[model samples]
Target chain A: MLYFTAMSDDNTLYEDLLRIRRFEEAVLDNFPKGVFFGTTHTYLGQEANAVGVLDDIHSGDIVFSNHRGHGHFLAYGGDIRSLFAELMGKTTGVCGGRGGSQHLQWQNFYSNGVQGGIIPIATGMALAEKRKYSDAIVIAFMGDGTLGEGVVYEALNMASLWQAPILFVLENNRIAQTTPIEMAVAGDISARFKAFNIMVRELDSSDVKEILPVAAELIAEVRSLKSPRTLILNTYRFGPHSKGDDIRDKHEIDQLRVERDPILIHAHRLDSNHKEAIELKVEKYIQEAFNQALADPLPDASKALTGSINHQ
Target chain B: MPTVLYALNAALQNALASDERVVIMGEDILDPYGGAFKVTRGLSDSFPDRVITTPISEAGIVGIAAGMALRGLLPVVEIMFGDFITLIADQVINHAAKFRWMYNDQVRVPIVIRTPMGGRRGYGPTHSQTMEKFFIGVPGLRVLAPNTFSDPGDLLSKAIFEDNDPVLFIENKLLYLNTIHDSNRLSEFEFFEQTPEPNFYHHSKHNGTIADLSNNYAPTCMLSLRDAPPPVLTIAAYGYISEFAYQAALNLAYEYEVFTELVYPTQLSPCDMGAILSSTKRTGRLLVVEEGTHNLGWGAEVIAQTAENLGSRLLSARRIAALNLPIPASGPLEEAVLPGIEHIIQAAQKMV
Candidate 1:
């Protein structure tokens, strides 16, 4: 268990959280209307994980994301219109729309590819950072499915051995696609990293107040210690794994939704004025973001063959 | 004639003198003993800092080279044997070759890996195996296999200076004693080596080409330059198998009507298809051979591709090659499994 110190915000944190919520809602609305193809795993229930982690990381700090990566990229100030364009394979998109729906990239920081494969690369980047003496932290975002890959262990071993300044954020959504936590995970998740002797923090990912401060402390500890750290953020999907697998059955989705609604819980914790203000601000931002993405031109003809934003 | 050891020593000496940026990294490339094979003899004494002995981790050596190349250093990493190179395959393929493309042309990995590949001195499966095919599959890699002694110097210099990619220069153990001369046959590598501080090395006119065997261009004729070659059909080969192929070619030419044109491919990966094509086209018949098992062996691939393209020209193109078995520790067994001179003679007789 971890605790968050009492601190005040300029309402920007609340606004950021609202922005994520509204953006997903807009995506859900537009997706079914044939404007978007493929699946999108919305982070409607896992807003705190994004806000909590991204707040501690600087602009120069690199982050690795997974299939459920829109919120992660968005949290790190990724250009919304460019990202949207990239998903649509438009020249205006971030990766020149080369990395469609599943793949996403922004500059040197890449959150494109399967979860586990990129973990070792993040370790390599951390190695490069240490060698170049750059003050860059590598954050590898993964889901429960990624834990099974041998790469995770290999990267973790190297990172811990090197005392690399890397943070492994495992968003334990209690389900990997349709598989439940019990069916998927064999050993205790925290115990898995204990052999590597890395610092671990298991906490309710719903509470931004709880998650933000601990992340700051852990990140600081890693920087100061020049060591790697892991934090198992127990989050929920709120929606299905993606748009294609929406798990639309009310009885099934509602049961999972009720107990694991991070945003609703956060709202319940805050005042009515705060919640309404956040919702209103977030709705406005989402509207603006959607309009901006919509107005952005489709990718130029040459960009169709381009496969990735980073490559282009 | 100067041996492969002499050529290697001269190659390193000249390369180091020409390029200040070129540095040699390996287990023992220094003065106390230049190397097990003495390829870098007297290198450490001449260029002390340039020849560095690394910890016994092939991966570390190559990885550091990759890093150094990124920092604008042309590092020549000697893995000693091709077998040990697999340990550093990740560093070589993933980091060095792909970094430039993956980083969108922001970085470059200019490094060269030199090692003696195949085996004949009873090193067995682990030490003797040839796996150039594994790496040939990888993109963004430039491989140079020097069949004769002379090209090692030239190809190595080019590999060191060439920017934006890594080069794999594989040397055959048998070719260490083999000799070559300049294109005009005026200056020999052996004589060039004997002469102190000689920079210009002549390319062998024969160039492992069968066409040159019968050509009126006596300057480029196989007989002009007296280098160590099998008597009958100097079957050009690379790695440790060169000795077998050369000897076998000679045996076949004497025992049978088939005249063997031994053309050793110095560069295996990014194979000099033109040179190979010319050799096969002239010879009309070839007995491709290697120490590696024949199921998709490097030599068989060359034979297959040649036979496919030059269907009409090919004269019984077959590989008197090794079977699908690891190199046995027993000397006789190893020889039995390996295609020998007798096998070469039989294949050549059938072809003729």
Candidate 2:
């Protein structure tokens, strides 16, 4: 069932995970020093879920993500330099500094700050693909927190009813902002999707070996049947929800960081030399991206009105 | 022969037949149900694959339509009622209306949201309301309301096929049964020809004393009685209220010798201020009417723009709108609050 079993393939996946982790670590390192004005939700522990799910996505396929989306964007080949510039609010940013951390639209990838707003939009995109008779499927990524929003249920109903070619990926990190999943959501999450007759798959996100094959299967089934499917990745976030908001017990986080670290788990499967080489390359690339982004100037105030409204 | 509803149906039919990418999505819009208003009657049957029957999720419908537009499909979404628009405001205002600008003009959301608005049918507080004023201030949204002269079919076609921006096409429940007055009583299914330009002085007096600058195409329309002296008052209105304003103008000309000029603008968002300002300068006195609540209504914008443009040339500018109260379900209470011909005439008489 495993789609990628080679040592080289594992190294590639390990490298992808490291890139997202290192890039976000760089962001966190700079944010507290006033190098970046606004806040960002770091994707520290959930890197494997993004890389695993995105590896199955084609160039033509579209992906939409929620607030904790830096990992998803990066896994889908988002430029590190543009992302750094965006975080710095530079004119060279993907959205021309209009969308800083939470809002980014690059090529076929889109992310929004709202928890469940993008679900219906991604469902609609899947519907469009179905209507066009194209095999392209859409992936909508949200956390366990998004289950609280009514629009997610509405989107699920429509996606199933229309048999839209979409894969709904829920990264259930067990915590929403500061609230635990059990505190905010009720009953079984997979059962909720099953009520709408959607096929569901559950995977432990810490294990990339399992996540990649399962995500690949679900994505293929979605494209082949032109129907909606759900992949629930049981993941965890190592960092606080955002900068300066550590509500969880530090002891528990530290324990999880040691026991369920996705990077550490994936690194064990790779050769030591290969892992070291990838780490060094990712470190150098992230450093260069940060330097370039830091050198870029902030957008001019006079051009503020340029992108406020479309002229044509 | 062609009512506004039928004209709209013809326009949709044309759009579906012409463009393979044009799709219609709404609740109960499939064949047999057609739509709540039957504006989409026989459309689903004609193009079964293109017409979509969505669940009663306004937010989902609009959000999906924006996605469809982003992926290179022209989606025409119908929200059964205007009051329900509040549910989808986040998607429309935050996503659809801002996608083009927020994405740095990399994408165009060529989507049209069609919904019926206004009071008259006693559908009650929730159903009977004119909320188009809420969307007029949204920068990227084009709000269009077709009156008797401004062909709904032509404008709907323009929004679906011609324009590349997101449009809020507001249809009045009362106006659905009415046809274009100058359409030569064409068949209900026949598509009326769109006029060349939006601004035309259809009837101009030889002495230039009475000019009827009413173009069938443009959002703004100016109507006056035949061979009347210069208008003492200019009455401006749009949507269903424009019918009342026209009637009041006729009464002012015949009964009171007020010689009133009526201006109806179909485009509400980027309002036709030039046409309104020119009429205000000639008449000096301006009276605006609307069916929406008086506070911050479309009439307020019209009066503000006219005053800003004409300044001292405007002798007196006033607005007559529905009382600032929630539309009640009771018939008498609804009539009590809504602006009518009597209110328009009385306001004009006072202004003049």
Candidate 3:
């Protein structure tokens, strides 16, 4: 079922996973210095979910990401400097600094801060491409917390009934802010998608090698069949939810970090020298992006406040 | 002889036939049912590929339509009842409306959400309510309502094809059966038309003063009675309530010998205040009528805006709106709560 088996031979996937890990670390480290504005959800431990799924995205494929979307944006080949500038609220940032870390729109990729809101939008975009008879598909990323929103089920019903060309990647980190998944979600997650007749694939791994092959198969099947599919990635989050707000036990978090770190799990597959080279390059790249973003000028307050009131 | 419903249907037909990218998505909007209010009649049969009958999910329907709009398609969503707009407020306010500006003009959501608002049919509290007051001041949203006073089809078409923002097209439930009032029919009241430019016409009764401003979008109408002294008060109303306001103006003139100028606006938000201001300035008095409840409603916003601008020149101003209570299901109770032609006439008579 895996179509792009040759992709496993290259070190690009290793670099992609490292890039997200390092970039998020920089965001958390500098957030105390007041370099970024508003709130940000770091994609600390979910690097494989983004790098594995988005590695072989088609040219016209669209990606709809959620609040914790820095990893998805980076894996989509988004410009690192502009993304950093967006977090810094600079005029040269993506979306002109209007959409901060949670809300970003660049090229064919879009992300919103609201949970479960992007599901229907992504389904509709997939339907649009299907109606046009275009070979394009859509990828929508959702979190476990979004399961509480009623609109998610509403969209899933239509996505299956309409047979939209979409791949719904559910990154269930098993915690919603401060509440654990056991306290929130009842029954099973895969059964929710299966009830709508959408085919579901469940994987509980952090290694990019295990995730990439399954994502390639599901993504290819969605394009060829022009129907909706779900990929439930049971993942983990290493950092606090956002800006130091973790209530989980320190020992449990540290234990999971040692066992399920996506970068560390994938690094063992590469040669020692090659892995060190990738790590050094990614560290330098993250630093330069952050420095350039810090130097950029903030948006003009006087002019930025003008256009929204005049709705002509 | 086209009814308001026929005109709205024609607008949808024309837009779907003219552009291949125009899509119609809603519940029960197919050929047999043709939507809850029948505004989308015959559209599904005509454009089979474009017309989509969706599930009974108001929020999901709007979100899907917004996605279609973001990807360069003109999607017109029909929310069966206007009261259900509460479900889709997040999608319209946070997502679709803010997409263009939030994205810094990188994309635009050209969507038209047509819903049947207002209550005269006794559809009860939940089904029969005018809810535009909740969305009047929304920044990136255009709230448009068409009546028999002008061509509803033309206004609907403008929202679908011309505007590049998200539009909430309000169609009053009672107005669907009413026939359009042709401009030439105003001759019965000694009315004369003045076309300052093509597609822009101003009609005024004999001896009534009119504003000189030009509106590029739908223009507001100023209705006054013939053979009466200059208006002592100006009445501002919109949607289905405008019809009753005009009737009250006529009754106030002939029955009570009280003259009042009536101003009806189709565009609720970004309202063209020039016409209302001109009439109010001449009269020195204003009365705003609304079908929705009075407290913090559209009428209050209008009165606030006009008062802020007019200051001391506006000698007196009042609002005639529904009682501050839920619209009862009983016919008599609903009538007792809602404002009607009798209420308007009484208000105008006392104001004068």
Candidate 4:
């Protein structure tokens, strides 16, 4: 049950989380100043969800992201420079400046074209992988807000009925932008897929120690089902969703953090001094990554207009 | 010799005959009832196992095709109508367009989306819609519309053979049953023991002619702007309206000595800029003709871009696309709403 005893020592995981937090902080610091025009839905507080899940993901296993996908993209071994380029809308960006932050993509495995947009895309990819990988699976990250979209449920129904190799990871941070989960969505969410005979699970997401094992178990169970499965990761948004807002709702984020910080949950479980050292190290790492991102060149003013229309 | 649908059938047959890997998927594309348009006809008999039918779910069909293509299976998924394409637009735009670029060029969504577009049969709004301008904004998706059967057969062959990207092949319903021959070149599928010499081919002539009526075109004389009498305006059109534009332009030339030229485009998506640019250069004034509803329609793009690029220079520019409304299902109402020769004449007069 204790699959992820303490990954704080894992250099790669810590570096990834630290890098994401810092990178996004830098994005926020520069956005209003006209330094970055692309809309970046920063993935700050949900680092553990991305790292814990993506760490176990095979490189061959296709990954799709929602608007808040910086964590998922970076955790899934995507390069940081391209991520930066994407936010800045540069030709060197993954999509050659065509797709900005929200549309960051590289190949079929990388479709950030719309919100909840990549669910069916992931299913489509899973349909491709079903015969070939046999063992591997497609993991799609969806926000709680996206469940309302028709295509999400449609793709899920088709995936379950056909028994496609897909894992629908619902990142229910309890808010769809400004609307709370209870306000935005109604009734039993798990029963949604269960009605279709697809397996569903909801887990407390603040604790990676708790979250990671559940993920591994559900992932295994879904893989065993060889059918579609939905795992709802009930986390909290610690940041303002993005940097544009300095304050997330008090009850929505502050109260949750006081009760359970994704990093704090893991840190508390470590040795007292070891926890202090991790905090210091993570702080130092976040600070440096943030600094580097700030120092990074703001995309050229012409970059935003690069891919419009060719009249000349 | 085959119609556009027959050409689609020929392409499917040729590709299936060449590779066991090709599979056709859509609604009612099976043997007992070839596709709604009969493009997949006879192929069910030729390749029974490869032809698949599904519940009338456009989203599910295209999503599955996107999946199948990733697995290295060439699935030419067909939608019953162009209007139904909007149901699966999210899948095509989000997945088919972004996959290869999102994953760092790792996954190839080699999907060929085949569907029929446009209006002529009085099907009206729900059944008659065109999808070119909207899809052009999608970056990773390659859009192609065929003017003749050979283009579909050859372009489809290339889409299936080499291009590892997603391609959208639009077939006009009018073109489906109409017999067409290209004097330009021979399709790879059109292998003739004795090839017709290029010089010997004659352009189909129209003596006081009228364009085909089945495609919603009006009877009009076809001629170039250079031959036109002194006229104050010109209009460009594509598909069924090409003929109407020609007719209206000729009438305008005679009635008011107004010069007008029709810019006929058989290809819709990735709109033919070459012809549009050249025609705009000559007349210096344009009114695009489209039968689709006006709001967020195809001709809007032409107007917008022309205004942005050539606004200051051109004499004037405007779009005469259909008024925004669900195309009327009734015969008379649909005809009134869609563009015709009379509409072209009036548009030319107003512009002049």
DockQ of each: 0.07, 0.34, 0.42, 0.19
| Clash pairs, model 2 backbone | none
What's model 1's TM-score?
0.68
lDDT of 3 by residue, B211-313 (tens): 1112236657777776768889999998888889878877787788888888888888865566788788899899999999989987787888789889998
- Highest-scoring model, TM-score: 3
Clashing pairs in 3: none
lDDT of 1 by residue, B135-220 (tens): 76455566666644244565566566533367777776656666743434534211112111212332321242111101111011
Across residues A219-267, which tens digit of lDDT does each residue of candidate 3 receive? 9999999999999999999988897899999999899999999988988
Per prediction, the TM-score for chain B is 0.78, 0.90, 0.92, 0.77
In Å, residue B184's CA in model 4 sits off its true spot by 9.4
Task: Please identify which of the two predictions, 2 or 3, would achieve the higher TM-score against the true structure.
Answer: 3
Error of 4 at B148 (Å): 4.6
Best candidate (score: lDDT): 3
Interface alpha-carbon RMSD, every candidate: 10.3, 6.0, 4.4, 7.9
Per-residue lDDT, model 4, residue A115, is 67
Cα error, residue B12 of model 1, in Å, equals: 11
Compared with the true structure, what per-residue lDDT tens digits does model 2 show for residues A200-278?
A: 9998758777688788888888988899999999998999899878799999999999988889998998888998999
Give the better candidate number (2 or 4) by DockQ: 2
lDDT tens readout by residue for model 2, B1-352: 5788889999999999988889999999988989999999999999998999988999989988888888878899999999999988888887888777666666677789999998878899899989988888887888889888667798898777656678899998999998676734422212122233633344322232312212333346667665768788878888888778877877887799888777777877766566677778888988988899999878788888878888888899888989999898899999998988999888778877
